[model samples]
Target: MNDAQALLPEAIWRDRIFNGDWIPALGGSHTFTEPATGEQLGRVGLANADDVTRAAGEARAAQAAWAATDYKERAGVFRRAALLLSKHHNELSTWIVRETGAIRPKADLELREAGAHLLEAAAMLTQPKGQLLASASNQLSIARRVPHGVVGVISPFNFPLILSIRSIAPALATGNAVVHKPDLQTPVSGGVLIARVFEAAGLPKGVLHVLPGGADAGQAMCTDPHIAMIAFTGSTAVGRSIGELAGRHLKKMSLELGGKNSLIVLDDADPDIAAANVAWGAYLHQGQICMASGRILLQRGIADAVIERVVAKARNLPVGDPAGGAVALGPLINARQVQRVHGIVEDSVAAGATLLTGGSYERQFYQPTVLTGVLPGMRCFEEELFGPVASITVFDTDDEAIALASATSGCLALGVITPTLARGMRIADHVPAGHVHINDQTVLAEAHAPFGGGGTSGNGGRHGGAADWDEFTQWQWMTIKTEAPRYPF
Candidate 1:
């Protein structure tokens, strides 16, 4: 039994499957290290453009049979896989913590979200496929949904489990084969683990192929003729390029990109409660999430009190290795990410933001930083820092608050904390973020809820719930005629 304590460090996670065979990666391999300890965990095979071509071709050939399979059979695969994921959470989470630099709780949350994704996909299979339509007399007409053949999924390092699973599970459940490219930094948790669970659950070969790869493989997937769609979750710049590629290829695409989300503390809010929410929203997983509260808007009346409370929490939260579950925050992904995070903070400080309690780092573990006097044009308020830096900007009235909220590339999430729920709702109505939270924090997620972003954050495509069918399938209108007498055309 592979439990948390019994798991060994040297266990290599080498998985690169094409078609039904386990083949060596022609693009060479990459070695991964535990971010907390800098210890070499394992190596993963990297794929090239040729490998993507081969994988997409095989997956395209396999998608027809998978789509024609009985709906019960398809639903069963997800059910069993969901149970298997839960059963193997202990072992998989060990790898998650070491591979992704996530704390135990965060690792567990990923596992739970993954399992929920599978279960939700299973239920989706049995839902109404299409709706009855009104047609001419003496004729029956219906509109139905059809799979998009093969889908290519590209995911990043942070929250690998759900980020990849969100697309993979739904695509497969809806009868589309998948060619997945997980970040080379976290292949095991992102790609290999999903493949293993589905394979164990009796999914046929070639229906799902996970290839740990680089930019070439990703671009190949985007341009590959056999692939019908692309689902990507990462930085905005990469997403924009992929969107362009998908557009050129005329392939269906879903891009969940970056955000510098805002959490607004209204004048009537309880400062202590609002501060707690801000701290959690900004610092969870070292502020690596796309929905992390990078900008905190404080109403001028309660600005000072909330800032003090937030500073105390920032100071008290411990940042270190998360293996033992003692640390509140774990290390950043690596030295490069740490440098990027610190560079953002340094730039923000230089741009007139006052560093309050924390702005330094000990190796990869960045301090839980809090900054004040942040304005619209400052780097901290403008760009998605993607680090544990809470930049607070003060606003006087509702008009000013709404203007501040609307003035950004950040459009993923907006949170407003107010004693009056109606006021919170009123404020939320003016914001253009895809997700709005009243009396809560910015980072909010549910497997059954519709999720995506606005403006730079997304291209108006949504994930989860009814959005799955719209994303993974194309609409087909069918009409039945009783006799040979048809339209004049």
Candidate 2:
């Protein structure tokens, strides 16, 4: 058995709503299966409205105490949590690999990344980043970031550890109590890992609650009045529904939704670099990512050359067991995702598109696929595929490339590849996306840079980095009138 298998008890961690006490799921118990090997791993309780209420109540009651704790004290707890995560990263990584079908190296990176997030949050306490603006003669204006009270985080399974808890670290660091509902598919890996960190850090049990359930449970959490904010990362369709719900409640929300992201290759672009990075961006995780470069816009002059390079690279990518070091890729999360990707590929071929490489399927594993002669109206280009398929389009000029890149209604991320720095910067300016990368893929995420999309791609607000913490917080402005001014209104 791997370290993760050893650390996690063979007996599944049963779920009961945590409301200062454990109780049975409102519905009943359900079993969870590992996607990589279609074997039953464990069971989790399915929560209903009642459980959401109890969990919200528990979080609400603990909010004040957690908020009252000094920022430095809270940061110290985060530091301890970071230490604990680092110590047991290998175990957590192995769990992530088995549950989510993530390759060992990528899973290991996520483990360390989780610890890094906590450490970064701990460091932010020393520098609150709140500011004091210009003051009038009689008054001094100070702006402070206040917690949102309690936050509901609904995470997806694609990236169990990173996506699941990305919001939690910032929400907790900024004095907000978080109710985290990890995706049912990989709950054990994400939930167990974070729970250990919190326990080692000596956090109050109710400060952070992990509720494992399905969509109904997630809706309950969103609609709960006690939830002051909702931070969600998942499909665009689901994000739209949750966004509407949060809006009805008038709760603060941060959504990192779906992306029909694109990579633009200028006429002068280096085909080798563009092809290699774009292929990696699209096929990583079997192309199951929000910002996967689903669309490739190539300048007419070099379109054929770039296509040749991408086809060769795609042919070389190996798909096999995630546990094996030689494997460069793994299966999709489940049979449903596998079908979805394959269906899209079939539709593309039927629509008069040319398949350069891949397009074969074996169970959950999908060979990397590249398509050219794709039209804008196709589902692959119009909507987020959320799978490992790239639809290629050629453009006549830089203007045309930029237009094609931004043509999709969704614009979470965009990549620009150009030999000249000036042209790359120019193209990036026109593309409407939350995050833009030059000469690189859109998967790039930095701790300090704000992440999220603009337009139909996602909601208005962003997350991560210094700016993201402020997103979960409301500003409380205070003005002190020390002495009487000449003119007082």
**Every model: Cα RMSD to truth:** 2.1, 2.7
Please name the candidate that would achieve the greatest TM-score relative to the true structure: 1
Global CA lDDT computed for model 1: 0.88
The residue-by-residue lDDT of candidate 2 on 31-127, one tens digit each, is: 7777767888777666677777877888888988998888778989988887777776677777788888888888887877777778878877877
Residue 263, model 2: lDDT of 86
TM-score of each: 0.96, 0.93
Identify the runs in model 1 with alpha carbons over 4 angstroms from their true place.
2-15, 18-21, 486-489
Minimal lDDT window, size 10, model 1 = 3-12
Q: Candidate 1: count the clashes.
A: 0
lDDT (0-100) at residue 330 of candidate 2?
87
> Which candidate leads in lDDT?
1
